[model samples]
Target: MFSIASDSAKSVRYVLEHDHADPNESIGPQSALAFALTNEHLTQKLEIVKALLAHGADPASLRNPELNPPHRDSSVGDDSMLLSPPPTTTLEAMDPATRYFISRADAPQTRHLSTLLQKSLFRPLGGVRYDIVGQDQVFEQLFTVLNLHSRTLSVSPLVILLCGPSGHGKSFLARRFGPLLGVPTHTVNVTTLRSTHDLWDSYSMSPYEEITTRTLAQFLLENEGKRCVVVLDEIEKVEEPKVLYSLLMPWELGERVAGTCSPRAGHRHIDVRQVVWLGTSNIGHDFVFEFCETSSGMSVSHGEYLELARLVRPRVSQSLGASLSSRVTTVLPFVPFTEAELMAIATEAFYSLGGERAYFVSLDIVEHVSRKAIECYIPEEGARSLHRAISSLLMDMPEFLEQSNK
Candidate 1:
């Protein structure tokens, strides 16, 4: 295959034969242009470099401090010509999202590459949907919740209930939609907060107040005037349900809950309606399904689904303050993506890599891995497994090139 070639002419002929555009034609984020620059193999590197330039990499895009082409000393070979000059173009001119796909080709340190990539690919706190397919309705609903809390709009108290079975993508939806709605999304992992003091110290605030007040204070200081999307992941795990009441009160009441902190010494209020609160849980649906089947001696015509908000209400009321509990809304269950959707997500991952040389193991690959993960009741990790599989596959390509040299 072209990807395993040792020489430039053969790779070029492979591209011409296949009528490919860039090495990225095979992968979504990985590109031949970026790959060529990263590979240590001098001759293959030159070929891919020429191929990238011939295809579309702006000659001017390669430059120092900008796209610090690997140092000559770090190159795979002693070929001084390859390291003597830097590539000459800004990442902006290349396929911006996938440009850094090859940034680690000759990585001695991946920190620079990771930092550059985090800036380039997606914003911090911004969400990425790895393999989600066909959730236009979900996206629309999220946007609706976000638009309601827009600073530009004067909206009423609003609470969004995002519930779903594990691996159904509720968390992914909230994270991705937060930025679009112009609200910063914050995820609360109650398990990470061992004690009330742990919670207070975690946010660098006083334990005299509930965790929500402190969290809101910090969020407001940094992102004032912006609506915030709060994701309460795995609400079932909270040791104290009262905590939920404190967290949801402001959003429910459309006012901020004042804390005993140095600032806001007295009770103060914030517009709660401006912040969208999303809670996800997997607790109730199974109970509901079993109840329906046994009690009625027949299942409902429609399928049963659990809502986290309903399941955790008693706890939320107990942990959170009474005032906060009144402002909450029940969560809705999220629909799972179909098989076709999973395939589409895989396709997108490949497309994002730059497609040309990117190789997807196949639907069988996803099924083999996902089914195994599902059997373990950890479908969420399936995407990660797929990533590892692809990483393993691509890792073999460079090694193949190395063997060809022998």
Candidate 2:
């Protein structure tokens, strides 16, 4: 990383070419491309970026968005240089995946959004380490989806169904989707809606509660014509499958229907030309557990996932009905966490206690917390029990207690 940040371009090229260093690596919070641009000379900075890109560096930059937001007239010359299209020779050297995001056959007028998507999605890239673990297949699918969405102006809203057991990062992915694709994302709990009318008009859960405009229709109105993601979470929990009829128009036509059902909505049709219609459910999680009982909550093979997905579809079809189920473009099955993956999650949770990122927790404490969390894990319920296990163990620890008392 320092070699790229150094003034000598030869040092950067030599490491990537001869040493075969990973171009996508991050030294702490910054990606190699980000660190490279910090060099003193414009000539040297360009050289380092080209070297990194040639070596298959992700153009979806891991640079913090706050520092690099589409600066047009900056005093620094590197902004324009960094935004410039890579030389053809450099693009030729890049891997197909890296090349597709930045270099399109027909670069659209909205091509700049691709750069935004790159910088925003999977933020603080931390090399390849992500907050959400054990879901590489999910990430790869989204990477391509977001890239396509970024380049287009009026693609239909995509419906993706995430099917699996709970606490397996399904909700985490829903929340991450907002920043991951650089679009406004809204999540509606299908279980909470009283009727299709509740989508446009807010209703009280109880008599004491007042009405609010925080409905799905309002979310659509706010981000109308702009690319957005609306997560219909807990889709299987809705009482009547007919409630999902509200989704058909938006999912298929990129046009969210709003009638004069309520005074707030007042018969307005919202055009959601570019939107992601995401749904999460645990329809066929039982089959997953049955298949992976011997693996002890480890990994699932590609063939196994395919088999699981087939089993999942019929269950989703049963719950959502035929028409709604067919709208789902792809069903992604989130596999149960492996022992190592669970341990990593626990360690991260321990360190993140009291909103700190630094690893203040001791190695012994980390191991203990992680083991207790994993031990208490419920396969059926997923890793939701992990936090409770961790919290119970943490109360007696002095470091945790010190931070809590503060």
Candidate 3:
């Protein structure tokens, strides 16, 4: 019955009505709701789960006991789940894991569910989950690109160039593509590779070799036939222009020379057709800022920003040379954080500090630091100055504590 319903919610309803199958009844360890939650087909799973929940399925029931117990039914009702209230100070101070459960208690399609589940279930246990704030449009575009790629039978990779100021979360966003898509991410710092020799060796070295690449080649080899995101961080920082040329084949053609010594000797070719190539850059920040400044109150609409990105794409291509830049699918522009967004970041930073220290970190302090950051904000540096402002406040904590005691 469950097998028949795996692809159809109508079948599930029929099974429930005719077979007298309980929606809450455990199939193996998982209830119908839990089973639907585990379904790989997201659209079908969402539909089936919603149907089950409507038919008296308990979301709190769990297939795994070792994991945290099902969330209390405080937020759930006989008919619909209530909307989650805004985060309180207590909720803000809680760890991500706890917050995940609390937020999931009320809503099925909660904003944080995808990110939280990606961290908890998709990633390896105890992996760091980056908080990607204020990049909804980027995520939307990325999903669209991936979906389009998936629908095609082509062997070419999806190439994305992220253009933004330093420390505006471009690299972090690239790394996040892994969890979001349920694949491993391999990050290569382009600045670290000095020559083509470094490139060949880094891409082909084995576990026995001392100068082996971190995880790029190994992950590609192990996860052959699987999708992945390959992030080339700070591509603009690469010293050798020819090295960028060497990567052109891989970026455009999804074909790369696979050998330890050189491109000729033991050379075989490897294909990374299922990979997403993410290149991040701090170029064109000034141009974006200048364009935005000429707009109403220095705030550009998303459409206007995209238009600016289109203009900046040519400038970046001119700088990086036509060969490397012409193959880029799209250049995504990450704008600087607004003052309100910076304040939110500061508050989040304070909450992340945890325990007694987090309690002491007031909104007033966050506002003060965020205001300072707003004043000192530079288009080239982006949110780095804001982060530094927050860090400096934390560094002065001892002095503040001493003063408070007096």
**Candidate that would win on lDDT:** 2
Provide backbone clash counts, one per model.
46, 1, 0
Span of 10 residues, lowest total lDDT, candidate 2: 121-130
Order candidates by TM-score, high to low: 3, 2, 1
lDDT of 2 at 370: 72
Of 1 and 3, the candidate ranking higher by lDDT: 3
Q: For each candidate, what is the lDDT? A: 0.43, 0.59, 0.57
Please list the residue runs of candidate 3 whose C-alpha ends up more than 4 Å from where it truly belongs after superposition. 1-130, 203-219, 260-266, 297-299, 353-356, 360-379, 394-406
Candidate 2 has which clashing residue pairs, if any?
Answer: 60-118
TM-scores, all candidates, are 0.45, 0.61, 0.62
Question: How high a TM-score does candidate 1 get?
Answer: 0.45
Over the stretch 314-388, how does candidate 2's per-residue lDDT look in tens digits?
888887888888877778877777666667666555544523322333345556667777887776766567766
What tens digits encode model 3's per-residue C-alpha lDDT throughout 124-212?
Answer: 21111224444444544544454455455557767889886777778767765675455767667787888775654445222222354
Model 1, span 1-406: residue lDDT tens:
2563454645663564466654334332334444445444433333355345333343333343333344454455655435434332333322211233223222223233223324321222212222143333343334333433443354655566554345556666655556534455566665556554343233422222235544645664455445566666665566865444445445544555444322244666554455556666654444433443454332222223232234545544454444555565544544443444443433333333323232222323433433332333323343444444444443544332233324
RMSD of each: 15.3, 14.0, 12.0
